[model samples]
Target: MTTGTHSTTAAGVARPGGPGPLADRTVSRVGYGAMQLERVREGRAAAVALVRRAVELGVDHIDTAQFYGDSLSNEVLREALRPEDGVVVVSKVGATPDPGGPRPMRSAQRPEELRASVEDNLKSLGVDCVPVVNLRRMDTGPGLRPEGDQVVALDDQLAVMTAMRDEGKIGAIGLSSVSAEVLRRALPAGIACVQNSYSLVAREDEEILALCAEQGVAWVPYFPLGSAFPGFPKVTDEPAVLAAAQSLGLSPSQVGLAWLLHHSPNVLLIPGTADAGHLEANVAAGAVAFDDATLAALDAVPSRSQDVPLG
Candidate 1:
């Protein structure tokens, strides 16, 4: 797979520019998520193929994590793409899979643990220095708390990453599943992006989204298709979402991606899928255009929390 294989906007058509500030290079508004690739039916080989195809389709940003298949996704990326190829692979630390428990993951927030996570990601991706490392907050403590709940303070985590950055172990810092308040507090540390649970049907992070826009930080939303888990109502299940997709002659998922791109300049879509066809369809969603009426229809969709936000 190679860059410049295709253009999202057709000639003579007004191409929409990505909103908000990003890194120095041009990262496509649409990125590929590496989580599902780890669990693909065809396993690692299929995962590697999808990453290559995504890069070929101009997807410059690939969101990954060491916990995703115990660094399975990063390994696929290392095997598929060269580190010097210039695609931005953003990874996260702070939580790891709980192999012995029913819980999805357990926190690894200690400075030493975070340092080890960063090293694992670097080694898995075969890169000397990672472009970005997100301090994914695993929990906000036990209870129903307001936004920006901090189990582990941001300053302590950033301090460790700052030292690593100074040593050239990582490039910039980012946060995952953090609130606006937490973000404001972390301003002194400098943030490059924020990954949070947001979609047409999940709108709890509006303030966070608005904050990122105001601060010029990239907002890369995970679960953009609603929730990946079963028994959850997907974004496509919403009446307004279905109606708009039918009228616009696009799939509900495609319409969802288009809405996110139109929602804000800093909003970057990293929709993931295991199927090769689905991956192609996701890349094509970047080209799905919308006008004022369509945008309004999508905006009116009701918000519903599928489950508690994950790190």
Candidate 2:
């Protein structure tokens, strides 16, 4: 659609404010995730262009990690972004890339490791301070879990993160892959947002989502349409989702993303894609609307959780 402050649906309903407060800045709910940029086969030039296109479409919040292709994603952002662009780059820490190890990434959850990760992000992004840095806890995961010395205490991690925030190394603190109890305990630290694996079909973290909503913390779901990993259910594969997509003249993926936007006001999406068309569609998904009947039908679809092995 239009690159305005707010996006409107076909039904004429406006997305109030179009952007919400995160890390002391109001950012579009439809943001870009930079992980895919690490794997873009077209190479760095195309990846940079995709990032620029995202900014052109009014995306202000970009989520990334230093370990994503060993800081390659952040480097792409470094080449593509400028201070005048006014984009808030959010990064995560908790793991580091291991090219030769058994896994692609390994837990870096020690307090010192966390600090090094933040430093890596700052250096790679060429920023003095990260707008937001999410502390990706390995307590619960669809990915790597801490072991041996990697297992760090939450309070210890938060202490360092808060110190960084006070030192102006990071503007705000967020969390990922944490349980409701962990979030509840961490609420006093001023969590700006939470990145969790949640979707129309995989909503195991609904409690955590509700807690974030109640506490005014933005809920940024990682897999808004499920994962490609086996055992995980894709929202597009749901019959009701397909039917709704057909009736609305939108892709099943769009329908899935739209359902998340409509699910809660505090929910911010960071759907990732390397293709130009998919990038546009993900941003446009913010404006998709649904009638009450369709919304209810989509809502009625049973939520399922599958334990998929992840590194």
Candidate 3:
């Protein structure tokens, strides 16, 4: 489920005491996900332009996937990027490519198969080894996996990734679309980041986010405005958020993003946008500052819980 609630940062987010991996990483706390850059021919140029613009604007992190167009997105990534400073490329593997596009297909963890995925992304993105490698598990399917099959054994995925890392094929290890228990079990093996659905309305990742904060791991919450979910609550349209946006003369989107930036230093938002104007607006949300009263007011909303939370 998704909750489209929106609000702004409450005062200044806890800044990095000094320099840290999560803080010093290339992408901004509010970074871009390159999935939106795919679709048609015209989209390619716009995506390239957006990547170039994002770098120029000090946005460092770029997330993509091998399943995205079977390497089309990777090609655009390399085309838009330069041998510059503070740029960390993060990509995921697991889903197979389809003729129409990348779909929720299946997961296979053979070492040779992973190698093929890597070769494709590396050649397309033109990178030796991407900074972050996200292992996308296949837990979403018809009839869903039984308890025994639902859980992906750590040793299995770790074996493949550990080999790849040792062979200098990946930098940091991360996971997407996983439960808190699964994440906890996988942490000891070197989980640098975790991507889960989290928001004011969707508290599925709430505990996971706090754990990441405690463990000093970066927590990347996708769909900040709640787009991935079907029945997610509308945070942006909430009475409190609407009132606050009206008070600030800001759009509902800006207020929503601002709330995440203010949520916690451990929270890293990767909102996807292809519209040029919307991209700039989304990035600008990273700079918003929410006051104490405003934070309270937004938090006061009686947000509904997610229908099927992994928390």
Model 1 / residue 244 / CA error / Å: 1.6
Question: Residue 63 of model 3: what lDDT?
Answer: 81
- How accurate locally is residue 231 in candidate 1, as Cα lDDT from 0 to 100? 61
Return the number of clashes found in candidate 2. Answer: 1
lDDT of 1 by residue, 105-182 (tens): 567777888999999998989989898899886433221222432355677888998999899998888888777788
Which portions of model 3 show Cα errors greater than 4 Å? 1-20, 23-27, 39-41, 100-105, 109-112, 138-152, 307-311
All candidates: CA RMSD (Å): 4.6, 3.5, 6.8
Estimate TM-scores for all models.
0.87, 0.94, 0.83
Please give, for residues 208-291, the per-residue lDDT of candidate 3 as tens digits: 788888887888876666545555576676777888888888888888878876777767766777777777787777667778
Candidate 1: C-alpha lDDT: 0.76
Candidate 3 lDDT score at position 166: 83
TM-score computed on alpha carbons, candidate 3: 0.83
Candidate number achieving the greatest lDDT relative to the actual structure: 2
lDDT, model 3, position 109: 48
In Å, residue 141's CA in model 3 sits off its true spot by 12
TM-score of 2: 0.94
Better of 1 and 3 by lDDT: 1
lDDT of 2 by residue, 1-311 (tens): 34454453222333322666686776778888999997788999999999988887778889999989889999999999988777889999998999999987888998999999999999999999999999999666477777889878899999999999999999999999888889999999999999988899988788888888888899999988987676778999999999999999999999999999899888998989999899989888888989999999999999888434385
